[model samples]
Target: MGEQNPLCVNVSTTNSTTEILSRYDMINWVNDCLHTHYTKIEELCSGAAYCQFMNMMFPGCVNLRKVKVKANLEHEYIQNFKVLQASFKKVGVDKNIPVDQMIKGRFQDNFEFVQWFKKFFDANYVGQKYDPMEARESTIIWGGTPPGPSRIGHNNKVSASRLVHATKPTTRKASGLDSKHIGAATQTAGGAEGGGSQKLEDLTSQVSKLKTKVDGLEKERDFYYGKLRDIEVLCQEREQRNGKSVGTEKILEILYATKEGFAVPEDHVEEGAAV
Candidate 1:
């Protein structure tokens, strides 16, 4: 999880004289090593060293739970177990007394550590609770006031909203002359006016060129459209001629039947059959 949500592992030892690490110290260690926050401790495991350590850090935390200890050396294991019991007693962890009694003389497998901790956490977990007022005050202290809007002129202090709604300032003459000083401003005004007129002429020329191009395009379009119309008229005329030829062939067939005894011309018969 993120730095704000992290898994916490509490290790304790049997040595009472060893310096005890605090919750904040443990958190700093976790952040330095794992780059995660130690917001809430979820699991507690006991051993000679771990029990001593946790007892010192969280002296009377009821949430601390015991896990089965594994050791290869039987004598050392017994010693560690005794140390854990002593540490628990020193920390006033009376709630775990029943668990200690039940798991006494029995060693939990190292492989089942994860499963054991999962069950232990699920059964005994409690979220950290904080006061609303304290939380708000802490936030205010840590996160100061929000930044103000950016300034424009040295004298003007406009807000962001006002700046968005403000209109752009119109361009003005550098000299700021008025009608009363018309004669004095004449030369400069004439120069500016002459430049503006030149620019206008250039724009008009460009417009004229564009209009000529559009007219040329329109004329070309009309030329193609006229050609298409002529082709359509030719097709219609050809279809009409074909219809008249068919009618003529039908009349020739009737004439041939009337002259049944007389032999019809071979060319005329072929032409009528083809039509």
Candidate 2:
């Protein structure tokens, strides 16, 4: 709704012939334009950056309110893409966003689309300054523990340590009391330790279960990655036999790509900040 008419409406017609932008160039362009710290193109798969790009080019067209900037799960990533696709339709951009391939976090699919987008952005962006963090601040859902592996495990370990500390028996200077009372106190202390031991065992079991679940997920991920790699190798051989103009060349690029664009000097690399 921000801009009813498309600005660079002619950009799409020439997109097929648009020169392939290098990975290093695209990465820097995206990071600079979006004020994001993405070193890898695959990180763009979350779709938040793309949504923001549209909003930057055509303000208010993309509902920043709908994008989950901190999305990690596949479904959450899909939601971000949905917002992006809707915005594209609204703004009259006819680009075919390969959401299916892009969401897989594959470099090639994302690279191809991002390359086209950079071309689109270049033609349309009028060099206006936009702060992506400020634009997206309202849209970030605030309550979850940060995205990554096992904050759960860290939390469980901390809780287990606290439980053990709280349940530990402390020795007291004996006030003169009957031996019976002393024995009773000892029995009560022993019972408390027993209860603590049981609770500790329960927590241990929970932690073990969590660990097992994580391992299984890792194996599943490896399995799919291996399959994708196999397919890439197969396609590569066929492409070589058939020559470089194979129909699936773009698809193969998506599979074959493994590097994170170009190398940044060790001193020049900027670390990503937390959202």
Candidate 3:
């Protein structure tokens, strides 16, 4: 990407309608005011004697450390203001207010900016209150065994045990019948699996044949491309050789015409000798 040109501003001491100042000029003026005091308009416009009147303001609730943090935040705000100034310059606006005046007007009747930063700090501060009782309850619920009927419930436990024992051999006989059925299913499945494998092999062979044909076609295409390139080179060389020959023929024809025009007549030479 090409580099963008820096924006230039025309500075005027007198409040003249002819000369228009830009947002960049206002930012520069504000930076100048931060350094020194100015009496003359040209001195105000120039780098020498502009005033430093603004100081950092801190909330009563915050400590010295918080004040330092707020100072950093103010620096970031100034940087953002500079970026806004650049955006205004890029779009070439016709008019602009001074940076200090704009800030003053925005905060004149409102404390919203200050209140917003206060709320931001309050929300982000991470001093969570600890609760020992709640933590213990949670640990017990997570780590302890689940509550239910114990082994001392004698009648119910004994009855369940007898019922499980009585059904055991009947369960074994049913499982034996299921095993026989599964053996027949296995034989049927083996036949289907063999048929699927054969179909897969046929597909694989067809794919290999198609791949070989495509490779052959690609090789043929490359061969034709090489031939076309060679033909183009030969045509260019022939045109160049023909052009040189034509130029030489034209030069020789001009020389022959000049020689014929300059030749002396035989009768004129005889008349001069007689005289």
Question: Which candidate achieves the best TM-score against the true structure?
Answer: 2
TM-score of 2: 0.48
lDDT of 2 by residue, 1-275 (tens): 48577544536535567876666678778877666655455667788888999999999899888888867666788899999988888888878888877776766777778877877887788878787778887432211111232111343343322222232211111122233444554555566575776655665565556556654554454345434534544565576578676466776555434445643333211211222
The better-scoring model by TM-score among 2 and 3 is 2
User: Which stretches of candidate 2 lie above 4 Å from their native place?
Assistant: 1-10, 13-16, 138-275
TM-score of decoy 3 = 0.19
Kindly report which residue stretches of model 1 are placed more than 4 angstroms away from their true locations once superposed: 1-192, 244-275
Better of 1 and 2 by TM-score: 2
Query: Residue 164: error of model 1 in Å?
Result: 52
Structural similarity to truth (TM-score) of each candidate: 0.19, 0.48, 0.19
The lDDT per prediction is: 0.33, 0.61, 0.31
lDDT of 1 by residue, 104-188 (tens): 2221222133233233333333533323223222221110101122112223232222222221111122123233244433444
Expressed as tens digits, the lDDT of each residue in 54-133 for candidate 3 is: 01111121122211111112243344345434443553322343544323222211122223222322333243442322
| Model 3 steric clash pairs | 36-50, 36-51, 37-49, 37-50, 37-51
